[model samples]
Target chain A: MSRQTDSQSTTKTRPVPPTLSVITEGSPLSFVNPDGTLTADGEAHGIDIELTRGLYREMLLARTLDREALSLQRQGELNLWLMCLGQEAAQIGSVAALLPSDMIFPSYREHAVALYRGVTPAELLVQWRGLAHSGWDPRKYNLQMAALVLGTHTLHATGYAVGARMEQTDEVVAAYFGDGATSQGDVNEAFNWASAGSLPVLFICQNNQWAISTPTSVQSGGQIFRRAAAFGMPTWFVDGNDVLAVHAATTAAAAHIRLNGGPALIEAETYRMAGHSSSDDPTRYRSDEELESWARRDPLTRIEKLLRLMETPESFFAELDESAERLGAEVRDACRNLEPTELADLFGNVYAEPHDSLEAERRSYQESARALAGVNR
Target chain B: MSTMSLVGALNAGLRKSMADDDRVILMGEDIGTLGGVFRVTAGLREEFGADRVVDTPLAESGIVGTAIGLALRGYRPVCEIQFDGFVYPAFDQIVSQLAKFRARSGGRVSLPIVIRIPVGGGIGAVEHHSESNESYFAHTAGLRVVSCATPDDAFHMIQQAIQSDDPVIFYEPKRRYWDKGEVLDQSDRNLHEARVLREGSDCTLVAHGPTVATALAAALAAAEDGFSVGVVDLRTISPLDLSTLEEQTMTSGRVVVVHEASTFLGIGAEIAAAISESCFYSLRSPVLRVGAFNMPYPPAKVEDAFLPSVDRVLAAVDHAMNY
Candidate 1:
């Protein structure tokens, strides 16, 4: 293996793009307008309306869950909560376009993606509540556990995609990360491996502009989508606030990845209207005026306007509102009814086989706790 | 029966495994055309086309990361990490991803990836070259760590590790790669069990990897002095064969652990603690450990002094006997 092969290509440098663009421009993909109305031509399309409605419903459900989770945190129930407040369109739309056969490796902030994949809202809450690692089974939904580490999951997703190619499975893998993760070494390594191996993976960067206090300009000096082109991957950018645009771009990119046995990139250029999480106070870093500007392009409001302009019956809007209320109430009930998990479960699943050392440690802890309880009694 | 060195046995085992299963593929730096730095993967690239034996870039993370993907794709990828010290860059992939994938998938996916690394000291290697870091992988959940001390063990264990559905971290003794022994045509051996290389009743000397050969040599040296010492080779490091250990220690009534890694938080520390808990009453003397001191591996000239040689094992055994 030490012999240098002339067949290996020397590293080549490519031109970088100044700005991101893919499905945001004028096209049959645009279902909603900036004025919150469906264009005259948009009203004629039935698939666009249905997909927009689905995105709106999922977003509403996610928002309600977000609110309830925040309440739980404030009430001293959860250890922490990372709210997916304003990037619901990027999550829901991209996930909706993915076939069930495709595997998704998500960062911790993908509440809407988890919901779309049918993970019970309560299950997602339990993890933040400090009761479990991840609430749902990954196999049942073809989703891996939410990785808390920033860009590490990207490498895992790339490895899995390579595995898929070796197995000759036509399935694609999607790894979701934020713009802030672009700075991590693992993300760049993932790009290199996926490109070198030609793994079937879709790298979706939810460019919500801010990673905590750090802005996108600080995270990357150039466009994130163009970063993929240098790796020989086809890249796409979507107005992540627009559900229809996101769906179109992700669907197209995913198809390209599946057909070409190589990685593709999708930069969902969205904005976070709310603070990063309940623990964060964006007032310290961002201006209210800037927040309001992005909120004006609210994904839900845009789609709702389009539905109304399509002359979709008032009954449809009423049903959706009612369903949102039901979902909110259901989340509330589930949170209130969540049972406390055993402390032993933490050590139990750590290893598949019984580890005598861990077991001994657990027993010692139990004994100490019992002794303290006995003394108190 | 055929006599072969540890490296030669590993090569034969790999060839047999590749011949047995088309899904078994080898990937690592210098594993293909160069047959690895130690020639453990010698002739594999020529026999099995480049597809089955891949020469990866000089990226350890990439090798392990891609192996995970290859495993997901239903290919049994055996990754070589070149050296024990070089495995840190891939620690995230092995511990975080490789070890957790099967459990994270909730049994929906099984990762049959094997990572082989040349470990331990005594060949006068430089820094970041000689390390017994099996404890790190053994402590991690969803991984099986094992080391072979003899040619016969190497011949059998490699095939056993490949057949396992779980991920296995296979540590090869780089220093003992050329040490030869007679390897039988058949090895109907259990990979999870410990082997009693040299039996005695006075005290037991436990070791694995390069240290196992050293402990065996010490046992031989002890026999000349009319001292009866039991020598046990711990094949499985993760799920340690404590059953055999407890049985041997109870009969021997004393024990000494040996390894090349720093003593603190090393495999010896874990084994000593486990033995104390399990065979507390059976112990005639406190469990003693003979391992590298808690420090960075010394320079090549001082490596022979840093590693646990037969003299160090005998010294530890003498100290235990005095107690």
Candidate 2:
């Protein structure tokens, strides 16, 4: 059978989602309404104006860096790049809600989350530049290294959550993945385990609409949030473009986990505004009109409108622009200054302890390199 | 030390290891309540509590995947994959995640996880259940694969494997689960070293896991035939301790490798390749290997023919002796 079909056809007993009717350009779960004002549920939109402005600033800086990284890859400085073009609010909101002790396990594209966690720009680009396996030290941030496998980090996060619970630590775990990852067996297994163990894992899946070319509607029969509910996780579907909505949802989810309420799956509905990567051309699969529609509902632009509603002056916008420009410059220098990795790194880190067989191979390669040099001379 | 069955010794070893370290967790299907199918983890959950000896959902990937997380969280998890054939579901976790995490993390974090699987064929069990799929793991880098032949090694090695600061695939020969031997107070043996069981001058019988006893029996029979042969119990197969293998080759000048797995691209093939490279001048004859032919593990009724027995090892020894 095909993976994604109409929900009624897939399961006769399962009713259509109640919230499916309310999911227009605006969702009731959204904190910031279509009119650019906070929704009636004040608790859900509890984040203050100060924090909202800070989130906007962080998102803007992340966007600046992401664009420069994309440009660098185009210029042949980086091997390849995956940009967080439209999912900045989703990552920024959820990461900001997390406590300092909570561990984060992110899939490869969570660049903004890593930056917010104090991972330097040079550390982020070194892996893309073909210098190292991972840029930042995982233990330092209580965040794991960027996992390339799509859905695997969910299981890792669940396991880590279970471990922390076992250790009696109140620290929670959050795993970040895309919409496509929901289709993987690892993610399903992760769901089963988290529910079974009553593990405190905040599963944040940025449903960015496209998995390379496959849309979410084609990835699964039902809504992504519905899958989590089936696994008995407290599931929340939010408008990911609204930073306030994401922050409020994640804050509640984090509190639920910290209070021993078990795992929660928050599916942030967003869009991937750019191609899948530097190698992809989205025009081949998706039409420009659909892109234009999403471009109009851009998260940054929506927040800018709200900032004006709050009577924020032009100087505030000017200061943000100034900081973003400087941040972009720093990212450029960081990517350029990363030193090339030595050949010895390949032989190193194979094992914590010394290994005779690997050492012999390393020695053999060195001797051959020297021989080739002599011949060239 | 009392005389104990291999499974009993393993159970005792697990209990001791858990007691020795509070962080060691045991997870697998039916392990907690059912005490595992083979009862290898019998009586563990009661003492350790349900939290420590967890009865995981019937998902191998989930078991290994979560164990990797627990390892990251500073716990040494020993995961039991129900049987040999059932291990493929967890293969990705073992190979990609558990095996690669420590090295890829640049030595900052260590995954001290143990994946214990009952391997090899015999006892008329169904297909899938009876398998010797050790080579797939042994071939993977960043994994330590070891097997135990006797109760003494089973008792001692389980603790040692748990103690290592790396992921170790501990394969227990299921056919020999009932085999009895004295559990010594302690064995002054490192976890990865090969052991010289019996010394001879004519040939060396190299084997591991299920086939080690067969090789030993072959050596005894070969002695009566005036073909003095040595037997080496290859305890660990990954960082293969070939120094003992080299010693066997140098002493006898002729050696025969044995395993229950298919000889085609098998662990025996690796042994032969290493011997050919290192013992090119010291060897008297080509390293002959006796293993199951490259075919699916046959039905139980015909498994005796498929598995390497004492006769097959002796036949290989005779062939090498003729050389």
DockQ top scorer = 2
Deviating ranges (above 4 Å) for candidate 2: A1-28, A33-47, A373-377
How many clashing pairs in candidate 1?
Answer: 4
Error of 2 at B37 (Å): 1.6
User: Which pairs in model 2 have colliding backbones?
Assistant: none
Q: Which candidate has the top score in lDDT?
A: 2
Cα lDDT tens digits, model 1, A1-377, are 10011101111111222222333333224545767665443354323555556667777777777887888788887888998888988998788777776899899999888877777877788778777667877767778788876888887788778667766888889999999998987888889878888888899999999999999888789888878767888887777887876776677777777777889888888897777887899999989998899988888888777667667888877886787788778777777778887675565655544555567778988899899989999
Q: In angstroms, how far off is B54's CA in candidate 1?
A: 3.5
B113-208: candidate 2 lDDT, tens digit per residue: 999999988989999988988899988888889999999999999999999888999999999999999999888999989999999899998899
What C-alpha lDDT, on a 0 to 100 scale, does residue B39 get in candidate 2?
Answer: 95
User: Residue B165 in candidate 1 has what lDDT?
Assistant: 83
Measured against the true two-chain complex, the DockQ scores of the candidates, in the order shown, are 0.32, 0.66
